[model samples]
Target: MPDVPLTDEPLILDRQPLPDGIGERLAAQLRFIAEADKLKTILRASPLAAADRRENDAEHSWHLALMVILLAEYADEPIDVGHAVRLVVIHDLVEIYAGDSPVFVPGAAADQVEREEAAAERLFGLLPADQAAEIRALWDEFEAGRTPEARFGKAMDRLEPMLLNWLDGGGTWQLPGATESTVRAREAGVVAGSTSLGSFTGQLVDEGLRRGWIRPDEA
Candidate 1:
């Protein structure tokens, strides 16, 4: 099976006569797209900068992809911008099946990984075999974070929510029990990609504290 182009609406393959093998592949692509639409309903812990509602998985992926493009220059080392963009875009797709896991939440890491891995396999499998392999590989690379692209991709993933939290007056961080240490610990991954970004986020943490949006960690 081959990759098929995605459309905003459900794919309409009836108009044209696809070659025998191609039709099934196209249908498979359509099915995957439909399945992916579920991502729009899975909300994350971060809120939109200007909106009252929380950000959803689909929106988060798009924002992170754009951030990857704009912030590529800040990466610790040179990276493949295109590959990084693909990595970010597909990174959250698994959440469609596994659901969004809030970083500050405790004791969920191991379970989240197991659930997301299962979700990745099931969701990616919906695509045509070749396309599925390509997407699954991209997801895996982003998860591993061994490559520069993956590192930067993960950085954007961590940074975007922090930025949003600050912009929304510490939206998620405003939850009563949240503290500086916990938030910083959760977002520490940003440092691996860019010390500059990490420093910038540290400043945001300070600002969050000053503005009384988050509590300080107990010594």
Candidate 2:
């Protein structure tokens, strides 16, 4: 047999070296892109507000981050509020591309997965590989609603719109001709995520009726 060289095998590199500050540069690039794409929620047509008065995705993120802080104490299950907050802050980043889907619309959610998945690839891809993967994982977790943090994050997501509708005297609900059953169905998962939040939502619904924000239609 021909003599085989001990070092004949090619050396496989364990990892590729990243360019200096590549992660940070990519993070900065993503930050700027996200800020520029702040059009998502703001583009939503709101009859209650002036034609120009719309909430941007950045504002939505800030609102939910605050909600996570304010409502963490009321969670039915113990959650790392920090993680939940992070999830909320990033959850709708895809809406920067996919646009916000009104929750009351039936079948609208069916297209969300495809739109958001593509958005995720583009948005997250702006970051360096490892950081992109991490953020993408968190985003996916929030979408899946499987983890405790994700459940809490989703609960907050639903709760914010309910509160907004109530405060604005059924703004979107009025436009969408939202019914009690529709509201209930949209929010039932929130209750499943956190019973305390569910109870609070029920109270809000009662308050909405009392305040003339909503009314019961004939059965």
Candidate 3:
């Protein structure tokens, strides 16, 4: 062969010539981001306000984050909106692996915490050590619902689906086995977050009952 050069051979892949540490960290972060994107595909039992299709975990999280910005003033206690937004955005990320659990589904929530805990570990572990720890901590805080931010985050979470269901004429509430008591019980968390939101949801549930869209609990 005439004047064969190393440049003539193509590399197996187009790899960036980044520093080892930087490259490794960037790869890990990218992998986590890719994995997190799956949340957009995981559907929830609740439908969009007026749309025929059901909502996905990613949309729910985004809605809760936006609601936090607009409704923070209604919280029973003052809240840190930035922190609340972060909590809401990451709150349902575990659902990407554990799957969505309907609030009014009988016996469905019994082992939900356990399943989500395992999912949190696996999913958050995809990030670099520090980032993984930070996200896991935020998730834990939201689950605990003790801090003001966490409480407000939860309020937004409960309020979004409730509004959608109300607007959709008792969307999930009309599903078989769903009843007023079961939904009220599950949504008790709303009052813990914001009394004003709690009142609004209570009114919606009452309206759903009067309209005969929601039946009384069999229990």
Candidate 4:
């Protein structure tokens, strides 16, 4: 019967009280799952493949998970596709707290690491201790982009938006700070994980430029 004040909190569903005496661990895990659902509300600059509107973090993550499953064979090195799927699924849960930072936006990446680090702690801490540590480690591994799975995960992460942009007629590539030169440079690391995908991305980038959908680098 008390006032539930409105706040700037991300669009999260109201938690339903469990039937009395549910164990704290299960409750905590469920609460963390619900909290992470806020990823659905975090919008990114990349347009949907339909190009009708922008996609949210949840959709983006789902797409990346599928991409990992389909494209793991293209990886430059052996990688556990299941592990890579996990990475893609959880990679943007941090965006629930930190919010989506669009790559094409100049200066938006400032303090991104610091913000995401804080968000990871606060968000994943919602889980029970051991589970929290495990998921947090995957999040960190994806961020570090060191291992084969993580590297391939990172490759899909970068490639998805590039594919989206090309599919959407240069989606965010038309935005400021997204010249062909910069995009190619930014996406060049895809090769570290998948030589095939990196080569394909190069072809797409060049085609976008030729079609005049992407901005050419200023001379």
Highest-scoring model, TM-score: 4
Q: In lDDT terms, how accurate is model 3?
A: 0.81
**Model 3 C-alpha lDDT per residue in residues 7-49, reported as the tens digit of each score:** 2222212233324555777877876776776778778888898
Cα-based lDDT at residue 191, candidate 3: 89
Against the reference, the lDDT scores of all candidates come to 0.81, 0.68, 0.81, 0.83
Expressed as tens digits, the lDDT of each residue in 88-142 for candidate 1 is 9899888776777676656535588888888888779878899999999999999
User: How does model 1 fare in lDDT?
Assistant: 0.81
Q: What CA RMSD would you report for each candidate? A: 6.1, 13.1, 10.1, 4.1
Q: Which regions of candidate 3 deviate over 4 angstroms?
A: 1-22
Model 4 per-residue lDDT tens digits across residues 38-152 = 7777888888987498888889999999999988899988998999999989998987777777777888879789878988888898889999999999999999998999999
Superposition TM-score, candidate 2 onto the true structure: 0.76
TM-scores of the models, in the given order? Answer: 0.87, 0.76, 0.87, 0.92
User: For residues 31-97, could you state the per-residue lDDT of candidate 2 as single tens digits?
Assistant: 5354434444344423323333545666667778898888887777788989999999888777666
Off by over 4 Å in 1: 1-22, 108-110
Each candidate's number of clashing pairs is 0, 1, 0, 0
CA error at residue 156 for candidate 3, angstroms: 1.3
Best by lDDT: 4
Please list all clashing residue pairs in model 3, or write none if there are none: none
